[model samples]
Target chain A: MSILEATRLVKRFGPVTAVNDVSLTVGEGEVVALLGPNGAGKSTTLHMVLGLITPDSGSIVLFGQELARHRVEVLSRINFAASYVDLPGALRVHEVLDAFARMYAVRRPRERVAELVELFELGPLAKRKVMTLSSGQRTRVQLAKALLNRPRLLVLDEPTANLDPDAGDRIRGLLSALARQDGSAMLITSHNMREVERMCDRICFMSHGLIVASGSAKELAGHYGAEDLEEVFLKVARG
Target chain B: MTAATPPSAPQALTLPPLSLAARRMRIMGVVRRDFAALRRSPMRMFEVLFWPTVELLLWGFVTLFLQTQRVPFVVTFLLGAVLLWQVLQKASNEISIAFLEDIWSRNLLNVQVCPLSSVEYLLGLVLFSLGKVAFAVAVMAGLAFALYGFGVTGLGVGLVPFVGLLLVLGWSLGLVGIAAVLRFGENAQVIAWSLVFVVQPLAGIFYPISVLPAPLRTVAWFLPASHVFEGMRTVMAGGAVPWDRMAWAAALNAVYLAATLALFAGALRYARRHGRLSRFGD
Candidate 1:
């Protein structure tokens, strides 16, 4: 497992410094949860790491190569999924997956799509346009697309943001299995405390565009002398 | 013991970097995805089939009343509309509007976070829309000939080439419209609409350019559509198509299209520089 490091990263939007001298490291086979209150610069950090936004200062390095210099090389193995981002509405579920699979250059897309269909239970709705699908179904499809290339590093803004409890549970289980078997590392953002407790190996607590605390879920919880991550989240978020 | 906990934990997880081939494939992926969207879209059917038919009937009535002594502008427009589908501006605008819809839906970041770059995304969209416009034009042309007997007096000889020229010209202007939308965003709707509206009255789609009122006549002469329509009428009317006039029109459209492409390229640079390329919805 190599290191993914953001060194002294700074970002400013006009008069505002969104990310203030923030730095963190994510390693292979590890899941990091970026927990923060609204407007805490979590998404901004993820955006900078992906090269979607450039920092005014500092740099992000993946596998020992600077991200800006090796963007194409670094990004090909990267995939992201979120409840908010969706495939084109005009595409059928099957077509959506097929297109992404082909885009990712999966050796045999039909086979890969079939595997996704089974994994996500998307077969029955394969013929339907994506816009017609419920949010949960769309989330599942997005996840299927994200996993199409067997990505190395995955970033999920809110993979299960709008799912029913049962569905969210299923997806969490699937993500757990994927992490255990494929050893894919992830950086996820969520407001769900229980999900963080169960899913993250390391939790980063962010406030005002800086990472104030990062450690194992239990460590942060115990370090703050809190009963659970939810209480720890409150203390950090209130700041 | 109830549970065995490991004391040592590997610090973090990582993935190997991607190769050149892998990177290219990811970009090509966006093109394929958009193509799939095109196939699934039903709006095109309405645009090519229903909209043209409706236009033919509705405008047919007006042309009949206005040009009782004349043949009818609807017939002329019918023929023109077949080719107008290939207008570079129209195809370009379609892709632009669709791009906005994606952003509004917040799905654009999903693709961007993957391997697809902004330029690659635009390329896929423009190419797909161009192909679609071509297909629709072909379809409408075939239907016009079958239903209305629009032979164009053996204009078929140079017809394909003429249509080809028009599409190339259209592609350049269409791309400019796309640039407008990407830059000005919602405010650019007026510019996009002008591409369609300006062509209608000035291009001589229905009536002869000579028939346009005195003040509007000068404006008509400045438009590429008038030249295209004049060329079409000359070929179909069995005239030599005034080769010199045709050349001038072609030259002018070429220059216009080139300028439009430049604008789009500039808009792209602006997006990249401003860090707005990756921005989703407003």
Candidate 2:
């Protein structure tokens, strides 16, 4: 079943069209990657999907309901995280997680927070204030917060951007396992081609506010006449 | 560190929609997050306690000096004005500062994208601000009695409506400040911190509206706070409750509240359309 269906989403900032005629969908348990160079309207598209930005013209259906009409009901079933956004810095790790767990109306908030604390290896850092944590540590905490609700669809923007290689690899592995074992759908944007290749079931390449190409990693590589996803990205981004 | 095993599958996706009780809990979540931050920051606590105490002391001494000049009932007038003005200041300042904290922490987007509606988020801020105002008022009232021997009870039952009107006016101004910040981004942050002061002269916090020049007095006439302060002075002067003044303030507040709420909603729409909210922290 389609977890999200966004059709012909267009957004403009004055004379600049940030996202134009973009249609995208994520199915149950499927991990989709949105890839593009800077200013490719990737973030705009993601924000529209999250209902943070109102599209100039479009329709979004989530879980087979119109998103505009059922925002609170639809949003309660999803969550988002981004490297550029932050949890409150003055709050302790556990407090931030607990607060979000409550915001998401999670059942058994304490247990959910404790479960995430262990899952993210945040046990030792739980008492530390969010500002005191390293960038990579903050990334883990954000991911943990994003899962507090056990959202059916998760939207992530550069989810592993700040993590060290070892931590990043573990997170990718954990996210893949979540999709495979838990049947959770995800829509993510990342510039890391290898990470996208490893985790995403399909990749959509965008440029100039439009999705120009989309396919599985191997198919995209073949369609672009490139050796790998990275070369394919270079070809699309440079065009 | 080794990766921990992933958790088991989530609960059924077709779970029931959020009930009204769950929605209220989400609002409380915003409040809890703020209170947790307040607990961790000594400076924030000090801000709540220190400034009100200092303002009271400053005005208390001024009234003491006036007493030497044989100014009859000056103590009640000056101290009463100080405390009432603080109520207005704290009520408005708390709301704007709470909003600013979210922007400064780069957490507005995180909060906005949740299931929490704008009205719920705003209600949380107003609720949190009321708590802060109550605490600050209690501290100020205590100090006023201990150090100056001036009791707010002297204002009698009139104090209730007086404070209520000021609070509504303050909330209206705070919403205006939030709308300004939303429309203009961080560059307009000064509106949150300084907008209250812009209304101070018109509010006639320490003086009668009649003291203003003709043009300014006309402007002050439309301000609900002016009627509140005028009514406050009448009460201190041993007159009746001035129901007419309170009525005027109440009616004005209704209009201001409606207009400011609409302004804030419109500004939020503009911000979302322009994608300014996503960059507010930057």
TM-score of each model, paired residue for residue: 0.82, 0.97
Please report, as a residue range, the 10-residue window in candidate 1 chain A with the lowest summed lDDT: A100-109
- For this target, which candidate reaches the highest DockQ against the unseen true structure? 2
Mind giving the per-residue lDDT tens digits that candidate 1 earns over B1-282? 011111212231111225455445555666677667656766745664565555544554554465676754445555554445345345645665556656656666666665555556666666666666666656655655665655433565556546655666555555666677667664775675556555677667655789989889888776666776777776666577566666767787778877876788688555533456455464
TM-score of chain B of 2: 0.94
Q: Provide the overall lDDT of each model, using Cα atoms, as 2-decimal numbers.
A: 0.70, 0.88
> Which residue segments of model 2 deviate by more than 4 Å?
B1-18
Query: Number of backbone collisions per candidate, in order?
Result: 13, 0
Superposed on the true interface residues, model 2 gives a C-alpha RMSD in angstroms of 2.4
* Candidate 1 lDDT over residue span A79-158, tens digit each: 88866577788888888888777555565667778777778888888899988999989998998888777766788887
Worst 10 residues of 2 chain B by lDDT: B8-17
How many clashing residue pairs, candidate 1?
A: 13
Can you give the lDDT of residue B16 in candidate 1? 23
DockQ of 2: 0.62
